[model samples]
Target: MSFHFEYPRTIAARRPGEFKPAAPKFHVRWQAPVTTIVSDYIAVQRQASDMAAERAFFQRMRRAFDSAYGPDSFEEMRQTDEAGMVNSIVVAYWTDIVRYALWKHVDSFNAWFRSTEREQEAVGYWRETLTVPYDRMETIFSEPYYHAGLARTRQAALEPMYTAGYFGAMRDRLPISAIDPLNSPYGETTPEGNYAGGPVRRVRVDVPPNVVSIRSGQVWQKAEGEQLDDYYQNLQPKLETGMAYLKEHPETTGYLSLRAIVHLDKDGQELRETSKHGYFLALAQLERWAAEHKSHLDIFKHALAMRRKYGADRQVVTWHEVFVLGTTPSLEYINCHPGTGLLRFANVWGNPPPSN
Candidate 1:
């Protein structure tokens, strides 16, 4: 079924001609290497008491980005939950990965992370960074004007290619048959020549008739050898069940779409990572899903229990940030790619090119 969004109209009305129609065409885009995505999870223990400081901290971060890379170099979005958790994500496209690496070591950049105030505050801070080469990535824009995610870099118009069904969209990107088990570009290889990397997982479920929702995330083990082996063996089954449940009951969940990807290192490795990253289309759905589903709760309780058992020093730190739709200037939309997150609901918020 076709999903409809109410805000695009409101957004358009507010901005007047900003959302006006553009040319009707399909396109393929490539992000220059080494493209990087940085996500920061900032949580205040006392929400009411620390709200002001949290906001100020975020503002300071914005200023830092502006001063270091110019306003247009990056895009940022913030999401806050009822439980007082806050997640801010910044996505920047770099023409050169070496430059991006150098900037991180700059005095001011290093100082921001080392700030004594941040360290002493009750707030917790964690960051994940991922850098990927251009050829290792793929992007599709359903219309000529829409641009978001990796599409933020370069785009070229292409002929329209429709999918046969829900899975077809994913197949268009990388056919299941062509997916290289040994040397997938999606992740890095281990010393043993095994693909021991974290790659984004995409799930698609039918909304009925003419629409579908796509959800994507990353899966990785926190520790090496036995610990990592046990983590995936246990987590994979639960993830499958969760995806099935979500597709089976979408209405009660408000689960339009979701994406949870862990940022990888510059070499595309995620070995023994301490933190993870994710973005949700709707925070309410996540809350509802977690509260109502035992599996979801089990995952949470298990993680907490494991941490307690192992102690903080040995346990993995997990955190996520949610983005407010359209708030990120860098998240510009030109068109909707079929069966992609949020893009599936483009019927509501998307601006389709003018019909010939």
Candidate 2:
């Protein structure tokens, strides 16, 4: 019913005749002031030639992964179906200091990783990390940025570019934050706090591949407390109101892809509610909405606090994304807490969850 492989003998026993390349040292160069790293990790258990084969492979693969990584229905990591396969990709950013550390010691890290027991257990899974460097040009800002309580593995080293001269400006212009080398989509560990660091740059993506055909999907959370009843009731009204707003503004044209409703909670209390609309040419419109109807944002936050007070539960919202085979644009949302509502935006859409 299942298959496993023994650790490769050649990797285990390195003969003296083997030529082990010396580990390369990282070099610190004053190149780009900003760097972004995107990481994609995938697990493949079985393969098939066609749809029938694909489905069968998926079933077997799920079973295999479940057996290997799950028991008593416990999950270490979670996955979602993408365009064609299940995948997880995370984008993070780093300052020059962290980049220097990675570049100098990557070879040594890779060597140890390949020699690890986990490497021995990997059957068909493969992981790849990609880094991109960008140059920051111009920025239009509304507020100062801040990041707090980041996970240990995901903390970024913020290296101020003293040489880049981003410190000051004369009285004629608005204050702007620009990275000397602005790297988008950098892969860093997730911060433990609710907010992402920085003033938050919003990006508009071209189109989404995953949620194109999907019109709706089910959302669930462990049902508990009075919060459960009130949360969903509040969400139902918000969804209707939000969708009505989008439908009224359907004629607009920028990054129209999907609508995502994020229902987040604190403990058993359902506290946060965010509705993201994948717009088409609505970048300017989104900013306008936030500016004009700031009061609505207050109502939403109050809803969250009310949910928290009653030991409420998970709130759910159904969504859709626009996708086209040739050229469909996309958008992403990064919601700020009580202070700013859905303040920052990114280009990523329909990214799969990470496996534990």
Candidate 3:
């Protein structure tokens, strides 16, 4: 039987509302008793000025991403960044850091990254990687049929979850928060023109500890007719607007950076899926935005309506994997545009929130 209301949680978990959820919810079950999983967000990007060259540059690097020592599973995604530059991203996953490290050693990736070739006239490249322990992460889904992110890691199952659609729900889902607040020592304060939007090559932002990141995705390749129409016509617009708001107003929203990507297959086939990769200073701030922000609420309202409309026939699938980073931080920007990835927040580590 599904343990929807009886899932394990600590004191951090929130009490449910008088009304049950509008629909069933689920979470990823690890293949075995594991402690950590490696999540790597690697991007090969370029400004309009270097578009053709960057695409050629990125194609040459594909072999490295698909190496024998590469991640257990991964996804190829594309996006046009806020700056109007285009980015091709590889969302790679490894059950452990050792294998990923091996891949790095075996592949020409590190060599190319450190080479002088990346120092050309135009900019393009960045990575935001995290090694999350089991206790520091939470995985939830709207349906048992579709899965992504860590679910591709040979998961045991997608079991029913108890707490969701409520403020503080993600915190309770993470076992560490039961005792520790998982607060970041820093805030999302980017001094305008200091470097955030300026020209900079080879930048590295030391991401603060306990910083939170989430990969929320939507898959609708299976939808047909009305369900498909609803997702694109109504639900998608809400999501786009919300993500744009977060990307543009990170300082106020506590979002360090947001990347909205369209999924693609290895063969360059575009898939009917999208993902939002958002980095925040703390989980509390993320919760605050989700619970109170108009942008997010709009998305929530439309999604709920779609769920109600389709009922069991709902072909749209949504899921997310949220985690708080530990002390070991690994983020880098190489010959990248000033606004690429977390490059905007480059070199701002452990500083108190910039004076209001």
* Backbone clash count, each prediction separately: 8, 39, 0
Q: Highest lDDT: which candidate?
A: 3
Pairs clashing in candidate 1?
1-208, 5-348, 145-334, 146-333, 146-334, 146-335, 147-333, 147-334
Per-residue lDDT of 1-356 in model 2, one digit per residue for the tens?
11111222322221234433232111122232333222211223222223343244334333432322121111112222212232211112223335434533542322432343433432223322222221111111110121111100133322221121111211001111121111112112111112332442221222222111112222334334654565467655555565456435534312233334332231212223333423233223433343344333543454446535532223332222111122222222222111121112221332334223
lDDT of 3 by residue, 66-117 (tens): 6767776777788888779878777778876777789878788778776767
Which 10-residue window in model 1 sums to the lowest lDDT? 188-197
Better of 1 and 3 by lDDT: 3
lDDT of 3 at 225: 90
| Residue-by-residue lDDT tens digits, candidate 1, 19-92 | 32232223333322233332222222234445565456556655655544322244444334323444333445
Q: Which of the two, 1 or 3, has more TM-score?
A: 3
Scored by CA lDDT, what does every candidate get? 0.36, 0.27, 0.75
By lDDT rank, best first, the candidates go 3, 1, 2
RMSD values, in order shown? 21.4, 21.2, 4.8
Off by over 4 Å in 1: 1-51, 67-72, 81-84, 115-117, 154-168, 171-179, 182-356
